[model samples]
Target: TILGLWSLASMSFGVFMGRYVNTEYMQSYWRIRAAGSGLSGVDAAASEVASLGDEAAIISFTEGTIVDDRRTIGYVAKGTIYCVAPVMRRAMPSAPVEFWAAGVGCCERRSNFDCGSARLPGGSLTALTYTAEGDKYFAEAVKEAASVYSITVGKRAQRVFFEGDPAVFIDDLWREAVVAAILAAVFHFCTCIIVSTALQKAGVRWVGGARGLLPGDELAAEDMLLRGGAARGKDKSSTHDHLRNVLDPRASWVEEKPERSCLGCGPRHYWVFHSLEEQHVEEIEKQIWFSESRTLDQGCDPSFFDRVVIAEDGGFNEVATLMKSINWYRYFSAFLTVGMIVYNICYILKSDAHMITSDDAGGHMYLISETVIKPPLDFVLRMLHIEGTGRFNANVVVPIMEIACLLLVLVWVTVLAVEAALVEPRSRRRWKNLSRVLFNFPPAIAGFSSMSLLHYVNPSVLIEHIVEYSHRRASLEPVLAWTKFVVLRLLCLVIGVDAFLMKFRMTAQYINQEDIDMRCVCQLAGFILQLIGIVPVSIIVRERLLRAFFGGEDASEDIEEKAKEMTYHALLCREMYRHSQSDLDFVVMVLSFNDVDFQGLMLNMNSSKMGPRTSLEVKGNAQVTKKNSVEGRKSLEEDLENDFLEVARAASISKARRGARPGATTRKPREGRAGGGSPPSPICP
Candidate 1:
């Protein structure tokens, strides 16, 4: 969508530029042919050229005036070489000069004219447009040459002629228009293919499109195994009864192992399932139930939602830290946005629009009338209520600011996109610090806000001209504005619709997948709205920050305070997710009896007797591949007992020492610590 809009904008700009150039082509040049020999006709044409204001004339001089191997005067100023050769009536010591044939970079020697077809037969020069600066330079060059050759010249004879035709200039304008249209087409299709392919691969399907079932769906489908027992060659009643027995909590036996042979600890109870298949079936059912229940339960786990405030890791600490590290870029973007807004606005408000002017091939004055001639620095002056207008060109200054802002925003968006879209929420503990930044400043919003910076800093010539021209030309503004307005809002609408289509498939984690799509859709949207939305996205972001930290009061807070609040919010979410996962794991383990029941079975099973408890235990331990030999089982039991005793004794000693100390209380280990070691055994006192 962004590419389509960009293409349309490019094509529109090309058409506008082409039309403007064509109009100028009709009025900007005159065909002034020499009437007689010896430079007389050239002089007549130069004198009459003043009537056509801001227009150039092409002068075809007579062959008699052509001077082969003529001495050309070259003057270097502002890093541009201005060259001119004298057009004289005759080659005499006192010969009067008609005019100077002018062109840039046409002289090999500072003193000789070595440029173009001036020395060829039937050669001629084109007249240069009148300008105060160009006039001064020509006068200076003529003066410098007079001192060396001792030839007299006056202001009347200072008329300059450039060595080119105006027809080529018109051709270039049309060429630019055609090229721009072509480029826009290429960009549009390429981006469409890329975005479409990515979306398809990521499982974003159209409505009613066929797709493989999710993990949760497959588990839910397993209900058919019991419902249609004929598929498994079993009676439906028996299968139903078997499933019910497996699901019943009382069906699992509870065994209490005595302390003496176990680990010198008090008796501990463990669940034991009837058979391995029953345990496996129970695990699947619990998973399916959890999945179904979670869909209905919008609330987070009570352990997470019941908290009064978020922890440092929960949400706010990361936001706080990230704001500090990234705030300057945000501030600068806000400033740039303001400057651009003002520049664009003032262009509309101000009378006598300033133009971007350059010299064409014919040394004719080429003007880009649709440009903001007043720099951003000028706006700064107006804001400060300075005495005079600011002349500093912000074109150079603003782009530098843009570069700095772009780099920061680019890095921030990249990391955030990767974390939110690629990294799992639970697995993000390893990337906790970086993940905090992601949550605080979502990748979608960050990219959306910085879209202008991306557009402004882009080196695309067509976009550059469109931006510059759109501000100056009032006629172009409404059309351009409406086009962009529709494009961006339409993009939002498309994304919103796509999200709706995938609503059931999208989890909290997968919601981050929309970030890339949002970035692509909304990136150019910023550039489009810069004029209309005077309040930058940064300012809005700042407002959100203030609300999060200071409860929406119009009050200032320290960076550290904001940082703390932000990271606190981030960590709070993390903590909530942790609790939710805990609930899910608990639900699955309790029904399956795999977590605790296996411990008792491993401890009490006798290798010699194939009794009911021993047979059930053997069938339940599906993960254990090799049946332990009688000697191996006895040795394993002794080793497990010894290790359990050592851990229990250590925990007991630690508890005793804490009790003996003054004002020392038992402290639980921090949640989510990596490799904190298996929590003290439940058997420990």
Candidate 2:
């Protein structure tokens, strides 16, 4: 069995290795083919060039000259010049050579009428200019030019070229293979030993051990098999035949011994044969007994059970027999799973509310009023049933709720961590547990804070503010708005710094760790939070204003340009978010730059849209005439405006179809139109 299992595993590994080898071979073959093709092309060009003249004479083929071969003639030249054909000369016109030469000596050269003769080398000398028959000849010319400058023809071959070191590249690969084979052998030996020990513990024996069976033993085993029906096997016919042989005690068990021996040893070995035979008999017996018990427990023979009970004076009833057994642990686990889900949902909702109420209310309210006039605060108003002006108390209630939720989430996570630590098996060392807790703690805190923040900050409110702000401004450019965003972000930084100082002091008292200061932790957390808060706000502000002012085309173009700039920003954000232990200050510095860039994008967008327009006065007569064409210009502008509105409407529709928000619900077709299907029945009635 062990040998069979190992063979199967080895076969799978072999197949994977074969596929890898095949892919490598194919790639190498293509690379070699490409190199050969390139070399051949270069050789063909060199051969053509050599055919023009003898080695020494071919070198002196300067100034345009026709080389006359016995069969053909072709132009040979050494100095290059701009070659233009008669047809191309007119279509794509170039200034006369004299015109360029005239400018070299300023006015003096033109006055003397000797600009070309004085300025140009080889003065007034002529050369044959050949026009190719088609693009093919042009392509050939390019190839010939490239081959003339080939590095392979000019540079000396390296010392390692002819006497190559096979060991240089192949040695590592050879060593790796050797190491892998050794590791595989060790693993196989260890696995086999484990299997052998397990088999002995299970009371299993080798094939040759079957002879110790008593006379009626085979018949008893056969009866058990017959009662249970045929056992499952790789081959159904073999299973039936085995059962039949077991049923007949007189049937020979000698035939089974040879096939049951270990793969490493031949069946001729006495012990190997005996071990295999005994193991087969043991397996059959176990299967038969297990099947019989299952059949009895399933009440397959109800009448037989009743007769047995009457004989034994034990009462039986249909109701008592019909009760299905239940696994209580499964039910308990399911209950716990459901409870955990509910707890998480409640925790998330509460956390969101806390964040929404605290720092985000002002921005949230402003946005909500712009979009909806009166946005619902479900928890504050609906849950508490507080109506009227009390609904506006989110500003006051949100911060307290946020802080409370953050505290609760922290405690909850801590409790969970402690419980996990306690329940986990003691096999894992203490240091590993401490490392896991410490590494995971910050994210857990941040996550809770993030959830709280999400509830309070309304994205729609922010987006609306950006849009409104953009409409009010004249410039509507990204740069200026980005500057304003930077200033506002700086203000946020100042506030964060103050909060950090206060919290650091409070945290120090709570932790009571004199040596391990809380200031570091507070500073880190504050920095992270500030980044998370500022960056997203800047992006949101910038994106909205860009979209509103520039329209889709300009926005897309700007985004593509900015995407390259933002890659570093994204990396810094990742570093901060992960809180790498090394170079904390460096990471923070990088993050601060990204923060500034983000703020700049936002401020630029804001100022460009919000600032007053500057009008320029026309001084030139041509400019006055251009301005005088007002009626025509107004008509063109109106047309453009109408077209833009139509485009916007179309884009909105497309956005909706692509599953943007406000169009998330899937629409159902009418029954008659939906393949003649019946409509779904309503549950309300």
Candidate 3:
């Protein structure tokens, strides 16, 4: 059971990891892209700052402008400007005046016009500079020459880097995965232990001696042998003795004296014959008298009728019939459990109608507006509280529903564990009684209530936390994947073990030969089917269908079945509650009885019929055989013996089976029917 739970947890974790972790790649890419975009924004801010003359002074001049004019702080020649600083002293040599003058004089003075430098008070010479038509550079330069440079600046450009660290995020993700996996494993293990203990207790109850026949309770062999003779004797001495005598051999006296009935006396010549006839008649009369006397002594009294009726109505057979009726309830319960399991599987697969979004609504709305002027599936959306009116969000509702579904599944698993522990064969009465006690534990209700409370307390915040946690722990991808794989393997192992144990336990506990064989076959077939991939497929399919049909409620049933499956698996693997041949026999006897005093009756029978001598011999032989078998068959037989011994000891048996060699034969009994009329003892080979 633990393994199955682990597998399921692993699967859930894997799915969560896959869906959420894959998003990280996209998140990372866009984050870097956003950073790059922010850099472009900084460049734009710098250009704006430069254009506002926030970093440099700007001045401008026109061609042929005099140096003395206030607007003529600079001179322009050949479309170039020569600007002088106001506070500068000696020629302002860094200014463009000298170069501009030289160029103008060399080109223009030699041809037609005389070009001279304009003198400034700062001792700087100004002249026309080179120019180009439609030059934005010249326009920019003129604007700069006239503008004042600002020393103080406003806000600096905002810079954005990648929002988070990839290494740290990956590490956190890995840690989360490991923690989740470990928690899942621990939970599974604990659950399995609880379930197994509960089941074993139940088994002990069902086969407890309190409910079965004792050895002394059986009818004595001597009594059974004498009952028929005593009954026959009583029938012969009844009020109908005359009629009975007609069919008796002792009535020959009357038949031989036939002539005596016709005459009171005989002729002298035939006196001898007459005397003989009279003698026969007298004997016949005496015989009739004796028979009549005995009839009075053994008369048919009214009390006999009462005793006969009581005998007819009471006995082991009646007890057997009553037991059969009681067992039907158990069978019914088993069937109900199976049905519950199936129902749970169906509920988990249904999709929430409320999860639809605007993206899905667009095409349908467009078509509807062109035709009926109404939306398709609008009723469904409204019913799900998701009509795109911002009243409810699919992002929130879907996750909430998913968690609820998971909780439901867990609850169902608990239910299944309870049922299996209570119902499956073993110590049935004890288990049933324990089940009654456990019914009040209320774990399922408590869990559901807890979950509901959790849901009610700020669902959005809860979702955010979950998302953040998942994101933070995304790097444990390998661990999550590996956990899932391990869980699956464990599930398979559990299934195998459960099937085997159930088969063994049932076979041992059932009294009816046919039932034992049938159970064995069924278990074997189930195991084979599981091995061939049918069981897992069936589970998956059933879960899907159940989820689709019943929604959340079915999840409980799924959990129950899975738990039940796992518990049995664990029990089988652990070889717990296994029975020895004698223990098995005792359990069968208990299950077969209805009366409370059945065990006592069995004890009585065993004491009287199986004498001390025979008992001692049987015990001695068993011990020897057990020892031999244990030694000879070290692998198979030893394991089988060990399992049997464990069950026997648990059942509180007085002695263990004798170890016997495989090929050894038993000695023949003396003073018994020819060729030994008894059948072989039903013990494990």
Best by lDDT: 1
Stretches off by above 4 angstroms in model 2 are: 1-8, 11-242, 245-403, 409-685
**Where does candidate 1 stray beyond 4 Å?**
1-40, 44-56, 67-69, 91-98, 122-143, 146-153, 156-685
Using all chains and alpha carbons, the TM-scores for the candidates as numbered come to 0.23, 0.19, 0.15
Worst 10 residues of 1 by lDDT: 351-360
| Model 2 C-alpha lDDT per residue in residues 43-133, reported as the tens digit of each score | 1112243232222110111232111111111112343221111110122122111001111121220023221122244432211112112
After superposition on all C-alphas, the RMSD of every candidate to the true structure, in Å, is 29.6, 34.4, 41.0
**lDDT (Cα, tens digit) per residue for candidate 3, span 1-685:** 3347756876886677555544533333333333332211111113232233211111122222233222222335566543321111133322322111112221221122112223423321221122213234333333443353311111321111111233343345455555565676687678768866654432221111223311221222122221221112223234123211211223222211113344433210100011222333444344334433322332311111211222221233333333334345544543443443333332222212222332332222111122221233455677788746323332333324544765675676566556756664664433433332223222222222111222222345345444533543334685775566445444434333432333233334344353234445544443333233322332334335434333334233345555553342233212212321343332332322222332222222223234322222223222322222334235534443454444334323322344554574434333454565664432222
Candidate 3 matches the true fold with a TM-score of 0.15
lDDT of 1 by residue, 1-685 (tens): 3347756866776677656544543223222222111122444224443444333344445435554225567778888777766766444435655466666676744556755555655455443432224557777777776765665664356454444543554344455545655675676668668766654433322111133323222322253342221223335454334333322223334333333455544332222223433345564444335433332232212121221332322332233232233234444544554455444333222210111121211122221110233455467788999966844432222323334554575587567656665667555433454435433333223333212323332235235445534544435577776577546544433332322222112122234452344443332333344323323454345445444445424333456666655554345445434443354432222222221222222233234333421122323232121112245344644543454345446646865776644553334444665666654423222
Name the lDDT of candidate 3. Answer: 0.32
> Which candidate do you rate higher for TM-score, 2 or 3?
2
Taking all chains together, the TM-score of candidate 1 against the true structure is 0.23
For residue 570, model 1's alpha carbon misses the true position, in angstroms, by 66
Please count the clashing residue pairs in each candidate, in the order shown: 26, 43, 81
